[model samples]
Structures are given as structure tokens and as C-alpha cells.
Target: MYPTDFIERINSLKKELETKTPLRIEDEKRLKKKLRLEFNYNSNHLEGNTLTYGQTELLLLHDKSTGDVKLSDIEEMKAHDVALSQIEEMARENERPLTESFICELNKLILVRPFWKEATDFNGNTTRKKIEIGKYKSTPNSVRLRNGEIHEYASVEATPAMMTDLIDWYRENEPSMHPVQLAALFHYKFVCIHPFDDGNGRVSRLIMNYILLKNNYPPIIIKSADKENYLTSLQKADTGKQLAIIEYVEQQAIWSLELSLKAANGEDLEEKGDIDKEIELLKREKLSKTTNFKSKNTVYDLINHLHDDLWNSISLQLLKFKDFYEKANNEIILNHELDQKLSLTIRDNFNLFKILAPAIKIAIKDNHLDSTDNFYDIKNLLWIWSYSSNKTATKDIEETIEMNLQLEFKFYEISLVNNKYELERNGSLISTTIIYQSKNDYDTRITSESINNILKSISKQLIKQIKEEE
Candidate 1:
């Protein structure tokens, strides 16, 4: 719990931020950008993000980087930016109460998919644990303190109950407690629980900020340089002196408050290196302003790359469902033909494809995408399936389920399964596979990651549809 003076200080700052009530457009831009960069840089740095403040600015603000940095660092930083936007929007909706599912989704946002790490248990044994995105930890998690003592967290069996209690405690205390104390206390309690396998620190900080932002206070950033002090305050709190962490957080909150106050008054909000970051970004963008025309980047290549990706995805995944039905036969109707008609081709006919590609290109160019940009709209799959109801031939085939799957691929996203039943989801897994034109001409092929998301979404829908019918 915070002392009266501490609560007073935070409220005083919050009241000051409120007078700015509806900041000027430019002022809001400066304040919001600074807070975002500071929160992202410091929080991630505390967790050992190798990117410097400059790199963080370059990547997050400008969408370009000068030097070689770890890809994971870039990804996590970008992911954190997205998560920041999400939480900010979430904080504005006072009508919507926070739930455990939102917390799990926050975990997923901060820690993206296909991630693995080396996790060590309390007994000093290590195992490679793949991150189960949006899920609680199945194994134990602990920290080793000074004097070689192991500080353990809530057990797997207790985590669920503990998390529920934590949420209940917050909802009960929210209306009564000061925002600063409430947010800090929640952070401390979450750290004690460590519900997730990774990104708990980041998640706790974001959730803490969510509380502050919702209550009209500028979010604080625990400077990565102060990792020791921050941890020390937490360490102190762990030992029953609750004020230490709350005091430290309040100190950081004051800095954010002052910065925002300056922005409110329309003063120069740029720090020392802000100009240099801007200059570097300008230099990079200047070099890559105009995209060089590539003949190979026609709609044909787009359709081709997309066809292989979707066909392979559909073939490999849909075949698995064959065992689910007694008689299952699928016709992959990839109608990228010159005439707008349906013909289920077992394989893409090269001669017909060459003739059809230009017509499809002309059609898309006329309607949706540009001919000069070579982004001729999209390609589609109109696949149909005929299946017997039962997998085992116990009786005569009384029921037949005909399923038609429609897939459409645009520039960077894909939408699949919009027919026979209501199931559709879009995926943003395109990282230089479907699009052929690039600053650096990326290899024109499908990534396994893209295929995997498509497979998972499609398989989930098909399984549900089949089960419902049966």
C-alpha cells in the first residue's frame, strides 16, 4: 500500500494530465509517440532486448533499421508496439471489464507464435520449452536469488486458482484504491504468480500501464538501465516491504507526467538523439523511394506463388480428413482460368495457366488493383469435397456431406473457408512468399509458417463442421 503522500503525488499528476484534456493534435502526437517509445524500449531492454534506443526508434517509428540486429529482437519490439496500441484501445473501453481470456490474449500478443526457449527448473535441470502462446505454464518456474536460494512461484496445480484470486482481488479493490497503488500492487502480485512461461515481466508491465492509462495517467517506463534497482524494489517487496516497489514506480510515473505536461504546453519534446534517428531514417527512405519495375512481378507470378502455397496447404491438410469419412474425394477447383468458369483441375495446366494468367491480370487491373504496380488483385481456390458420413462401413452410406471451401489470397493476407457453413478467418502470415516484388527480391515460394496457420485454421473448421453434421 502507498502512503497518503505517494497517492497524493500520483493523483496530482493525473489531475495535471487531465487539464490537457483533449490535447492539441501535434501535442498529442508528440506525447503519445514518446510514451510509446519509452515504454517499449525500457520494458524490453529490462528483459534484455539488445536494440538500442536508436534502433528501437528506427524500427518502431520509421519501419527501417540500419544495421544487423537479431530478428527476434525486431519482431518482439514490433509485437510490443502492436500490443501497446491494443492495450491503449482496451483501456478506453470502461464498459468492458477485464477478463482472464484478455490476459491470455495479451500474453499471446507480447509473445508471438513459433517461439522456443531454454527453461531451467528449480533443481538446476534445463529443458527446451516451446512457448504455448496464450496458455499458462504447464511446468514449474522459479528464480535464483543471492545466497543461492531458490525463489519458487505458484505451482502448476495452484496457478489457475491463484490467477482467479488475483483477478478477483483487483476487481474488488479497483474502485477503492489509488490507481498508482493498485497498478503497482497488481504488478507485484502477477510477478509472484508468474502465470506464463515467458514474457510475464512484459505482460505485467503492460497490464500495469493499462490500469494507469485507463485511469488517465501517462504510463511509466522502468528504465532498462535501472533493471537492478527495479528488481531490487521488487526484491524488497517480496520480503514484505511493499512500499519500495510502489515508490519506485511512482518515481517513474512522475517522469512520464512531467514529459506529458511539457507536451501539453506545446514545448519541444525531442530528447538529445531524436534528430539523429530522424536523419538516419530519412537517409534510408530516400534510397528506397521508388520501386524498380520487375516484369516477373506480374499477376501471373502472384497467382503461381499463391497456387502452390494454397494447393500444398489444402492437399496436405485436407487429406488427413479422409480417414474421418468412409468415402472422401476432393476436387481442388483452382479456377484461375481465362473465362470465369469452374473447372476442377487435378493439377495446374501450364499451357492454360499461361493463357489464363494475362486475362486474370487484365480483369483485376480493370477492377481492383493497378496494372502498373503489377498488383492484379488476387487469386482464389474453389475446392469441393464429397464425403460419406461414417468412417467405418457399419451400414449403407446413408448420408453424404459435400463441402466447398473457397480460398482467396490478396497481397499479404489470406481468407479461407467461406462456404457450406459459416467459418472464416484471415491470416497475416505473408513474409515474402505471395508478393514477388521486393526491395530485395525475396525467394518466390511459400513459407512453412504460412502453410501452418492456414492448415490449423482450415483443419479446425473442417473438424468442427464434420462433427456438427455427424
Candidate 2:
């Protein structure tokens, strides 16, 4: 259903790409590395694999899945990349025709093993279904859309027949159809059947690229950032506007071709600072493009990340004075609003970070916000943490945090700062840092060495004040 101009455009790009038949070794390696990582990352990420792009690259290169991530996600990413390699080999075997066996095998490889999955039966009941690696679905697998309507795939009894028909149709059309149209349509029909239980989405994408690679086109990446558009395009296709999805895939194909052309010219694939930008973009990829910054988001994330580490570092050294100040608490205020009024407390800091690296995500992805002004106070408290700067307070309100206590309370009152910190003892000053930027760069200092030094000075100052008063 492609327009004449669109088909001609792909053909023109395709013909010019053929002239650079044998790209330089370095260029080929760079392009392959980029494509392999991008495809595995975006494909799994779309299906909710929690590994960041940086984590994915580390896993692919050094076999290190950094950050707090699931063992299963690491294995899936590794296996999925291996499957990409396997498909590359499969695509090169021009003598062999595409088959259902290969597709099923690809699924088995990506999934790694059989597992139990939560599924919705046709009767609209939640059921725990056993998912076998490489097996077609035995139960009715359907999904509920955002609109609260059920979207059904082919019937369980008809799955085998439909899959066969799909494979037959693909093989028959492979020689005559434009590869982009062939791949896009195959992906559409296969996902419609929803042949397998869990990996259908990932497999459909893998096979889509397999079709393209067979025709010597670079693999197209449907980026995780554009997930809504990806799904919406398919939803429109479901409405009989088939060209909507084809056009979407065509645009991706053009990007792939342009990159390949750049590689053939021995040019850099990524722009300046693009790698850091990719990491940053992928960092927020889990936070759907639709997500707005909120308070539950701030306080929850505040407790999970380096905040606890900041506390642990400060408290451990301060522990020597446990006899005098056994338990101390910290709080945040906005215009005289108390901690009880705010959503944060010391107890909120737990191993909650193990759930998902500072953003337990599941912590609060809802409309429940503590502030009427769209949680602006919460946002400032989370990002630019400091007392003197009064970041947590609005201009209309007086926000007071203790940089240094009066020493009359027989203890030290500490404040988290945006950058620097100063400790005072009998009106003398010692400058150091308590909380600095974290590796993730998500928060303000709230440091170990500085905390220890400042705590020592303050404890001495408080003891001297107590003695003098006595």
C-alpha cells in the first residue's frame, strides 16, 4: 500500500547503499555494535525490561549489568542480543526460506526458559498460565487496552492454523514484495495471532528486522522513547488504516538506511554528547513520556537513592555520641509547613531502592500528590537540596533550615546543601562537604568525609557549650 514516491524513495536509498557493498572494517564494527545494542535495548525496553541503555551496553560489552536490575532482565538482554546475532546468521543463509520453526526457536532463545505468567482468560478472569519456551499458547491470551476494552487475538484452537498461513503467506510474498512492506505486514499479522504467551511482541520485532536484514537493509529501531506512537500506529492499523503503520515502519527504515550510508562513508554514527544524551533519555524511558513530575515521586525517590547513604555516613560517625543523642531526626519545611504536613520522614528511607535504583517507580505512579500547586515544593526539595539557598521554599514563603544550630540544644542541627558546607566550633569555621552530587546526579549532597568532620566539630562544640553552661 506504499505510495509510488515512497517505494521509489526506499529503492533509491537501497540502490545507493549497494554501491558501498563492503564497508570499512571499523565502520562495519561500529554500525553492528550500535544496531545490536539499540535493537536489543529498545525491543526489550518496549516490553518493560528495566535495564538502562548504559546498563545494557555494559552488559553487552563487559557482561556487567550495572545499577539495580533483575537477574532475569540481565539474562533476557543477553539472550536477546545473542538472538540478534543468531538472526544475523539466519538471514545470511539465503538458500533457506523463513519458517515458523526458526521464529519459535528465536522465542525460546530470548525467553531463556519456561515460566509462569499472569494472563487474562477470554472470560475476563485473571489466571496464572504456564509459559513454555518455544511453545504456542495453550490458553486464550488477550489484553485490556487503556480504554478498558478487550483486544482479542486469534482463538487458541485456530492459532496453529493461522501461524501456518502467516508463514506460508510470508514465504510466498518474500520474493515479490518490497522488503519494508513485507516485514511490516508480517509483523502486523503475526502479532495479531499472538501465537506465543509472553515474547510475541519481542519476536514480532526480531522477525521484522530479520526480513529487512535478509534484503540487505539495516535493522530499524522503534525507540523506547516513542513507545506511544509505536502502539498508536498499530492501533490505527487495527482500524483498517493499514498504511498508518506501514508509513511508521517506512520512516524507521529510512533512518536505518541513512545511518548505514553514513557508516559506508566511514563517518561517526553518534553526534557529540549523544552517548550521554542516550543514557539520560533511556534513564527516563521507564517514566513514560506521559508521566509528570509529582510529590509522591519526589519523597519516595528522595528516601531510596543516595539519601540513605548520606544518612548512614553521617549517623555512623555521629554514633559515638549515641549516649547523649541516641536518635536524631531530619525534616523538610516549606513556608513553616512541617514534615508531618510534608510527605517525607526518616523512616521512609529503606532498602526500597533495591526495588529499582532510587525510582522504585512502582512507589507512586498515580495522581495522589501532597501539594495543591503541582508539587513544586517537592520538586525543589528533591533536586536542589540545600538549606541556605531556600530551594524548598517559594519566594512568598520563608523556608528556614538549620545550617548550624545554636549549640544550646546540646546537639548538632545539620542541613543538606546544594554545594558546599561549613562547620562552626565556638565561632571558628571548618569548611567541607556533607552531601555532593551522586553518580546518578539525581540529588544534592546531604558527603561522608565532610559529614564526619563536621559532626566531630559540632559534637565537640556542643560538649563545650554544655560544660560552660554547667
Candidate 3:
């Protein structure tokens, strides 16, 4: 029953993907609502299937017997509900358009959740214990179960500098890595860092999905049933024994991509083209590799593909607009006006694409493309832009182009601010800002020097705010 809902949801998503029109706020709201409904329906269906005969009997017996069995079950059920509720709330709060920093912050949140207090060892020792669970034994102290022994573990404390370093590395390197490979490496490194005393496994998994979701991919659920295999893969990755983690992540991504495709198409499921083969072909054709491909070849290929697809879709819009004017039989002036508006829109899209170009290039610097896969269809590209545009067209196409360019600038500004904050934590300080000013007088003059001064002031203020938060 749970799987049925999953399939149904996937099918719905596939249909949604066909609408290449830009996303409006209403569309986003609708999506959120539908997602919540699907999540609840599936969760409830699973809970129903998991109820045991004894549990059913106990419910009936509680009405007849004097024992406290019913009460105990009720308490346990309530606790479980509370935990799930907390998790749902956290997930909802973190929901937003995907960004690298946002994903990292979410990972931190999942890692630091209080749920660790409830995790217990074989000896009934909770994760809260400061000393190793079994000092007399040879088992290593850690939160994880090793062999048949429960070991006591000491938590590794991390300085602010260490966290800053990790973020910097991710920012500097992630663009060049294949999204799957980058996600897998981050999972491995974060777990190895063991930034938190406990819950590292769960947190790492959450982080993996956060990255996927941000990139318009579905989430992967590492079921408790596959715990052993999952742990083994992690161990292999940690020891540098093999690319087990990478393989695992790739498999998960394939599964997610398939599910999303199915959902968008309103189908239960369907066969997919071989992803590895496609990648290989892309490589052979030199389509997967980008100009900046160097180290993280796979990630670079994916990002570049996405960027190209987006540009192509926008170009199609320009062609369509041109056709509208060319084929018109009446309203020559109105057609001209419409054409002008669309041209402006195209120009705006171009500027936005230009701003995003660097980020895509950065993402590709590490991985040379081996092959190109059509990960994004034309409709998907349109959806992304529509959603990003927030349903409002600029007063003129040129204005729209300027607006998108501004968004890119703002994204960079934010990134720079974050970088500065990280550096300040390491005893270095820097400030930067951007400001726009206007005068009412018709012949008012503006100077680049004044603009620079405003930017500096804004930067300094941004730094000050960051420090205050610290």
C-alpha cells in the first residue's frame, strides 16, 4: 500500500513536470500542499501495515484486562508521534529553493537535533554517556554498533575554525564534482569529522537528500532494512577501500530520478535509459566535459548540462516570440509591441544566464565531461525559470533582464558575505556591500565612486551583523 502511494505520487510529479511554463507563487503553494498530502498518506499507510496482531489484541484487551499493557503502548505511540512531528516540523522549516549554503545549514540542524538523547546501545546505555559503554572490552568507543559489542565512545569536539574550513572547502570544490559524487564525498567527510557526538549517520543521510532535493531531485530514504549494507558502504568509503559510497549514491540518485520521472508522467513506473552508459557516451562525445572541467568532472558535467538546457529553453522562448510576430495577420503595432516585450524578456534571461555561468563553470572545473545526458527536458527548464521569475514579468523585457542579472549579483553578494564571516571566525576580518541610490531631479548625476562607497558601507554593515550574530 505504501509503495502504491509512492508510485502514485511519482506519477503525479511526472505530469507536473510537463508544464514548462514558469512557476508562479500559486504553483509553488500547490506543489507544497500536494507533497504534504502524499507524505502523510504514505506515512499513515506504513504505520497501519506495521501494526502487529498482538498490538491489535492488546488494544482490545485493554478494554477487558486489568494490565497496564494498553497504557504502555499508548505512551510509546505518543513518543513516536512526537519524534516524527519534530522531524516533520524541521523538514518544513528548512524547505526553500535549493542553495549550497542552505543545504549545509540543514545538515548541521539534522546533526544537532535532540533525538540523539533517545538513541540507546545494546547494554541500554544511551548515547548521552560520556565514558565508553564497556571499558573492560576491546571494542572501540563509538555511537555505532561494531560486531556484537557495544563500545563506550568519547565525542570529538570541533572548533569553529574546523567547521569554517569544511564549508570553505565545500564551496571551493563542490561546483567541480558530480552532484552525486560531491554529495557522497560530503557525506563521508562529514561523518568522518564526526562533528557531533552522535546521530552522524542520520544527519549525513539527511544532508545527502537535501542536496538532491535542492537540485530538483527526489529524496532517498535509506530504509532501516538496508542498515547493514548502508553501514558497510560507509565503512568502505571511510577506509578508502573502494568507491562503494559513490556507487551507492549514484544508485540512489538513479532511483530518485526514475521516481521523479514516473511521477511527472502520471505512470506507475517505467524503464530508464542506462545512466552510466549515457554518461560514458557523453564523455566520448566530449559533451559532458565543460571548458573548466579539471578535478570534479562528473559534477561539472551535470551542472553544465543543466545550464545549457536552461539556456536552450530560453532560446526557444525567443524563437516562439519571433514566430508570433512573423505569423501575425493583423494588429501590426500590437504585434510589434509584444515582440519588443518578449525581446526584453529574452535579454533579461540572457543576463541571468550570464550571472549563473560562473557558478556552472566553477562546478565543472574538477570533472571533465565524458558524456552528456539530457537530465533536464525543455519543459523542466521552463518550469525552473517560471518558478524563479515568481510569475511577474518585468515592465520591459530589458528590465526583466536587468532583474535577473541583479539576482545573480545578489547571490554572489551573499556568498561573499558568508565567506567573510567564515574567515572572520579564523581571526580575519573583511567587509563589502552594494547599494543603489536615486535622486528625484531630472538631470541628476550619479558617479561610480558613489556607488563604490555605498557598496563598501553595505559590506561593512553586513560584516557587523554577522559579528553580532556570533
Better candidate by lDDT, 2 or 3: 2
Q: What is the Å distance of residue 151 in model 1 from its true position?
A: 1.8
Regions more than 4 Å wrong, model 2: 122-125, 271-273, 277-470
- Which has the better TM-score: candidate 2, or candidate 3? 2
Ranking by TM-score: 1, 2, 3
For this target, which candidate reaches the highest TM-score against the unseen true structure?
1
Tens-place lDDT per residue, model 2, 205-239, is 99999999988899999999889999888889999
TM-score, every prediction: 0.62, 0.60, 0.35
TM-score of 3: 0.35
Give the alpha carbon lDDT tens digit for every residue of 1-470 in model 1.
45744667767877887877789998999888888988999999988888777778878877765433454576789899999888899999998777889889989988877455778755567656767878999888888887688899899899999999999999999999888888999999999999998889999999999999898888888988778899899999989998988888888888888888899899988777778866755655564333322232533453444444444345545567666655444344433324333344322322222223234334444544344433422234343443444554333232212222222332232334324421121322211112111222211234446557766766776666556553
Q: How many clashes does each candidate structure show, in the order listed? A: 0, 5, 42
Q: What is the lDDT of residue 188 in candidate 1?
A: 97
CA deviation > 4 Å runs, candidate 1? 121-123, 272-470
Question: What value does the lDDT take at residue 320 in candidate 3?
Answer: 34
lDDT of 2 at 387: 22
Number of the candidate with higher TM-score, 1 or 3: 1
What C-alpha lDDT, on a 0 to 100 scale, does residue 169 get in candidate 1?
97
Per-residue alpha-carbon lDDT of candidate 3 for residues 1-470, written as tens digits (9 for 90 to 100): 11222334444544465463334555444444333323322222233323232232222223221111222233323333333334444445544433334434443333222211234555766543332211111223354456664433323333234445666776676566555566677777766655544334544555655555544545554544455677788777756754787666666555555554444444443234334433533443353223322223322332343233333233333333331121111000001112221121212433443334344343223232223331111001111222121122321111011011111101111011122212224533333222332321111112224434544544454335434532
Highest-lDDT candidate: 1
